[model samples]
Target chain A: MTLTTLPPPHHEPVAPHDLRARVTDVLLRFIDDQDQILRDVDPELSTMTTALREFVLSSGKRLRSTFCYWGWRGAGGAPDDEGILVAASALELLQGCALIHDDVMDSSDTRRGLPTMHRRFARWHRLGDLHGSPEEFGTSVAILLGDLCLSWCAQMFDGCGLSEAAISRAKPAFHQMHTELMAGQYLDLLGPARGGGSSERARLIIDYKTARYTVGRPLELGALLADGGPELRARYAAYARPLGEAFQLRDDVLGVFGDTERTGKPAGDDLRAGKHTVMMDLTRSRATAAQRAVLDALFGNPDLDRDGIGKIQDIIRETGALASVNALIEEHRTAALSHLTDSLLETETQATLTELAITVTNRDY
Target chain B: MTLTTLPPPHHEPVAPHDLRARVTDVLLRFIDDQDQILRDVDPELSTMTTALREFVLSSGKRLRSTFCYWGWRGAGGAPDDEGILVAASALELLQGCALIHDDVMDSSDTRRGLPTMHRRFARWHRLGDLHGSPEEFGTSVAILLGDLCLSWCAQMFDGCGLSEAAISRAKPAFHQMHTELMAGQYLDLLGPARGGGSSERARLIIDYKTARYTVGRPLELGALLADGGPELRARYAAYARPLGEAFQLRDDVLGVFGDTERTGKPAGDDLRAGKHTVMMDLTRSRATAAQRAVLDALFGNPDLDRDGIGKIQDIIRETGALASVNALIEEHRTAALSHLTDSLLETETQATLTELAITVTNRDY
Candidate 1:
């Protein structure tokens, strides 16, 4: 599955903290350069650069870049390949676009302990005593910023100083990632609209939105950039698929059960939003007729109080749905870890990726 | 200003009709390929492909691509370069992205005599009796579609079958076009929010939104694709700047005064929307106190009547604003044509570009 038989490791695997620092450095430098370009266009345009810089530098897991870097290392790419860092950092920009637009679509007010992009802009509109609806202004500004981030993602990827052949080889994977992300988002919107509450529908959304987009694509992109053969890419996907799903499953668990301060969201936020997660589907299927009435009345009520959330949690636990979901998360995490046991991957890469699988699937936030 | 000396024409200039037909061919083929990709992902996704196909093929002036093609030819590129057609056609997708998002921002119900993308999606939501607000559903779908178009524009441009040198040479123009278009859109939004009615602000918006985006970048992209020297690109920009401004001026005039059937919009659409065009700035500055009072009362009023529109129109005429705008258009048009007289450009290209200048600036819709 590996591209080549490499020499024994001469150095320890890159720590996640080190990888994050490098990614931040690349992003900060790129944003500064863009700030100059936008300033040259007009002084007013500096607002966009400022917003982008703040949102990007504020907070992120940098998980996608970490996985991508390991994918490259696993495929025998040099440890000191600076171009790969730039290429990996592009994913963060794409992630920003997704989060900004997702917040607008969901009417979300906060993220990572601060107001969402649209909400932030709306506050600016109010502060300026600007004409028109502040909410509309905020939505428009967020949309434009999301688009600029998307465009910058491409620009950064192409200008990463990688070899022409490497870039060309990875272009198809990069392009498909964009299309798949949009498609998955569309499906997410469609699911609730179509009254889809089945685990099947929920799983399908997670497959596209999280598993493939967040993990498989980034990993494959790195492998392709390192000129890895198709076999290596398949192995990456095998590991990424279950791990990504587990990552999202953990997120679902946190939405209802995790501490508000740690998760940077209100308790039971998904219940208030009526989000149709797999856990919700499991609960619904397992609920008795009497419990179903409680579910129907309480779930999706924007004004649902703390007491209501407790009742729902009690039902989920009573029916063993919560335990079932926890079991599924553990099962997927184990499956993902099993793929890293293949001998083709370098020993250090295997160890790091194994650690990553545990951390992503077991994190509190 | 052209890059090289060329012999007399072996063929007549490509007529506008022929170029449009060729552009349509490229677009249709690209859409079909994308249709297969989407279908492979999910059958339900066919709705996106169908909507995109209808919007793209139904009606468009193809002005950007026309200017780009001629820019290439003017810089000594062959008329029969199919790859140039692909590069040129990418502009149409970018335009699609702009118009779709513009409609959402404006909350326009119709475009090109048909329901806008959001409206169309809203109707679909209604037909299916879907959950949530249909308006919100429509906005979400439109946003995703717009992002998809923006990504496709870059994908198409890179895969245009051109040599690496040509693609790399044109990449900066392509990158800047995306950034400038978004920045211009932000300024357009900022203008009215800030209550800016100055002609200077209007002209700045036109420079970024229309002049540079619609003409300057496309022309430079074509020239660079042909490997034209800096002199040729600068010459193209000189011609493009004035012509593009005139083109927007003509659009402003049509927005206020053109027949509804020809314009595919309501009567006095710009006035109803409170658009701050250069013509509007001129009208405001020249109005008497009494006329100004009338404008302040009726302009931008969502429910403005025909009588109110007529009064506003009469004041613009009485103040000579309309006539002055027409004069400015002619002056810019003359300047644009003057750039073509340079002996470095081929005779046939010069003639075709001159013809194009008149058509774009004089169109009804």
Candidate 2:
């Protein structure tokens, strides 16, 4: 048989949008499977399964899966590896567990312009006219749902059609990713508990809470699947850690200064929540007497409104902390990209990773 | 090999108290390993780890591990099976995770006469004189700690040194145990939401939430590891389910009628918390119109005090509901013990399981 023709060599690398669509497809299918499984256990749980599907599939970028995909490809993995896609998609459920529980812990009412899980369930408690206090009902539902998601994460990962050898080899990385992320979450809880930590401590939290699992370990998981040696894993981590920090730093900036339309959260929402983000630490350390007075009056104030937020924003700008943070982001972005230079990854994978790096640093949301 | 002496057949079967202490040894060692791992990650997290170890090793009867060990021995597993013990101890950490998060979901202030994880952390927040509301801070800390416990459960299980074949075989059972428990919790949330469910529904909740996982699956996990056949597993489940149901029924009774010193909860704490247990369903169904009205007024009332609790108890006794419940417990207890006959288990192991069945039904706490 004669080949007709070949596609152009200069075609763009795998677009993140396409990757996201595929990952979402895998996730939705998993949710549907879970619905059926849960149905067998109890039909009364159908409402919960429906909410779980919505909470998972309806929102957020599948960023961790993307990192894993590229890392798999970079480690000489095939383009058509469905096992990687399915296994990586489990990360979304893990992320879902984190978000649902995080919202309850933070008492957040909204996420992605929709009511957070606890808020929705709390309202459902009232609307269904269920027994007990609505608030407790909501919190309980979220907790149970979250625990379900976490259990499903392990179930999906083990059942993802990967060879037993591949799964066994990659188990440590997977396990470490979870332990680190949970520790980081604990560190996040400690931020305010420490009564306004030093800036260095804030950065440490970012590294543990956001960096390794969010970026590095996802990549490492992919690499491990392809038998990525220690050298390759280290290289993947080199690119991952700095990039993950940059991502969170940008997120912190957007939390304070980004438009609500793009960010999906109200302006100064993190401040009012007393997030104790690195941005807050940096700005507070740099603020003048007048700026400090403004921060003290308005920051984390429950009654904080547009005008009060505007005052804090104005002070942040005046302190030049905002500009310094941007400068730091640029530094991290450069350091992250620098790791790409010597990596043995394929050209297409490299192109996609480069695209991802840019998207993370520059995104408004 | 020369036999020095013949062992006496008059020796006691697996004493639960002794088994509990041995299981505690395994758990404490595991926690120590985790402490080292976590310490290497962050020294600042010492308090969280300490709390976790204490919360795990300091309390509870190690019932699941005991069930698991005897199940292993009964399935003809070796006496030298450290893997079985290690895998079984993982259940305690899983239980710890469940209790910590469950307390948060319930907004419970105390557990085992100690402040619940959330309450203790909240108090820590206040004591630290840190930022944000102490209540919020405490809740956040508990959520993270619970999440940590959950992740550790998986890690410890996978690292328990069981053969890959054994682990593979047991994975589904372990995963299902988690899913069912969470589903049972969701159903439990529905109980109060349903405004006191039917007796059958309450029993169903107990079966799902407590029985199958707490009693049955631990035994199943042990059997699976031993490569026990379907007949053996079915036998274990038969013995496990009814016993577990009886155990929970006894707990429900103790929640109402047992002494505070023995129960580790205030008298009638379940009534105050609006726990829609089998005891509540049985008692309420048997009440007169005036008693029903009283039940409605007292049950699920946040302000329910000793006086209100006494009234509910009086009605339960007057209507003979308590005696009927005890009869049901006995029925289940007998059904459980009957399954032990004609079993494949070793004589000593069978004896231990029989011993366990009695202790469970008779427990004061």
Candidate 3:
């Protein structure tokens, strides 16, 4: 079914106080309950479970969970705690698994102002006087623990109490999201390794990895599980797609320029790690020979010290690449807003989603 | 559901021959098909995928798939190629995911006379003059690749055309096996690191990690999917449990003494790597102070030369640990055979399973 086109917005302000608070409360409590269930699986596993739960449930905007909740709500389903919470919790578990594994893959020592799970396990190994190499021991534990979390995510999703038809319909979309995300990740990894790829390739990776899976699928999954017909699904995707891209573009900007305290990461981590992001592509495409040489030397170099990072950041700004990327972010944000206006949605739901989209693009964290 | 008991095995071996041939043929073909799918995911990814698939699939006995097929046939279902092949393929996929990830975790450089996936990826990174640390790039690629394999396994299982009820019933057992296997792996990792866990702990890890999940669960899942009633289920478990233990016990013995060509590994690789196996535990528990001193110097030391491994091996044999572990393997095998006789299974099914169990314990590979 096709989504109905929405008329231009009337000059009415849509306040978001109630929906925001309700979504936050549901998400936080649901995550806590899931953490409890994870721990309950084996009390002796408390150390690993507790650490993972804390990392996942730590303060964040919970944007994906919010999208899911509103998507379900927008589909004409009453926001029952069980369904919303379970869906939200499952998403959070998946996020946890991804983040933990991602940190290991990236070799990032700290996350959320704490040692990453692998590093923490490594410390434990050192303290325990483990017989083997501490680093190897740490990695082994972390890998197994992440697999546990991934397994738990599937199990929890399966047990979400949604009807069989709802689950069956949503399953393909869920699998697609997973496959796309991994493919996107593969592109990201291959980009820098190959030393060069087109701007189109970089943009596609960003869209699939961050835009669609992070926002589009979660929103669609919620609507699907709520038994929304095809029209609502189409409408939600219309709103979610560009908004998700804008959100990731903003994140790409932050990864290079945001404050360490706010981002919970070392400043210019993306640049130093040589991540082949959209912003990087914008800079590279427009760079002079001397600037390109500098970029090659600094970006993706594990040996890049703080001064090297600072110089690279300065070069990025000087090349006008940062400004252009910022402009692109705004372009996507405006386009997303236009799509939202052109979709069929209830007045209240529209307002809530619009506010969320704005927050996503503007948020510092 | 409790499994039924099997009837006494007659001296006939004819029933097992056809089942083994069919199961092996289907399993190898499935592995080839999956490798093709992996290559199709991205042609660029073929180099690594082909190497991994070949290393894992070549000349290997499809033991787990065999158990699954036998379990299905023993459930009193008419022997059918389609159902058996699908279930066996699913098991093979699961095994592939486990091995790929496990090799990375163990930091092994080779598998089946070929470079491990991670190691191969590392070699590619170096050869291509990739921009990042070769080791890190290798690991990142391997991690993402393994995750892809895992997700594909789930998707393939979901598409296996099993009835919803059957799929649902089999899922818990599938999940449970994965969880137990990971937990057991953790215990094994932790045991070696800690170096002071009780012998019982080591044995428990073996039973759960290698014995139950590797053999018991695969067999049970096959039976359940084939519509095995409680009686048949319990009977299969009774036959599988001890037989599975014997399989692992034999592996422990082989780890220390088996030929490199036959085992597809270097002789005393486990000793050199300082694996905390049941035999190791038994040796430690019985060692005198002088013997303990020798082990302490050699065990888990990265500096261990060829002579050190040989010395450790000699000590293990001298302490009678080898003989005792071998004796335990025989005992478990005998118990499995006795249980098979005591079970109330169909005569034909019993004969097939009995021969399979014996082959597992006696096989050199």
Every model's DockQ: 0.64, 0.67, 0.49
Point out where model 1 deviates above 4 Å. A1-15, B1-15
Candidate 2 residue-wise lDDT, B242-361, digit = tens: 988888988888888777776777787688778877767777778899999998898878789889988988888888888777887889989998888874777888788887787767
Sorted by lDDT (best first), the order is 1, 2, 3
Which 10-residue window in model 2 chain A sums to the lowest lDDT? A1-10
- Top DockQ model: 2
lDDT of 2 at A302: 76
lDDT of 3 at B11: 49
What stretches of model 2 exceed 4 Å from their correct place? A1-15, B1-15
Number of clashing residue pairs in every model?
Answer: 0, 0, 17
Show model 3 residue runs off by greater than 4 Å.
A1-44, A59-61, A288-297, A301-311, B1-56, B81-84, B288-290, B303-310
DockQ for the candidate 2 complex? 0.67
Per-residue lDDT, model 3, residue B350, is: 77
Chain B TM, every candidate: 0.94, 0.93, 0.86
- Writing each residue's lDDT as its tens digit, candidate 2 over A64-109 gives 8888887888999888889999889988888888999988887888
Report, for every candidate in turn, its global Cα lDDT versus the true structure: 0.85, 0.81, 0.70
- For candidate 3, write residues B1-365 as lDDT tens digits: 00012233344443345555665565456546655754555556455456545544563666677777777777765677576556666666556657767888888887777787788888988998877678887887777776665665566566667777777777778777767777677777777677777767767776777667767887788888887888777766776778777888777777766666767777666876777777888898889999999998887777777788788888888888877877787788887778667546777777767777766665553
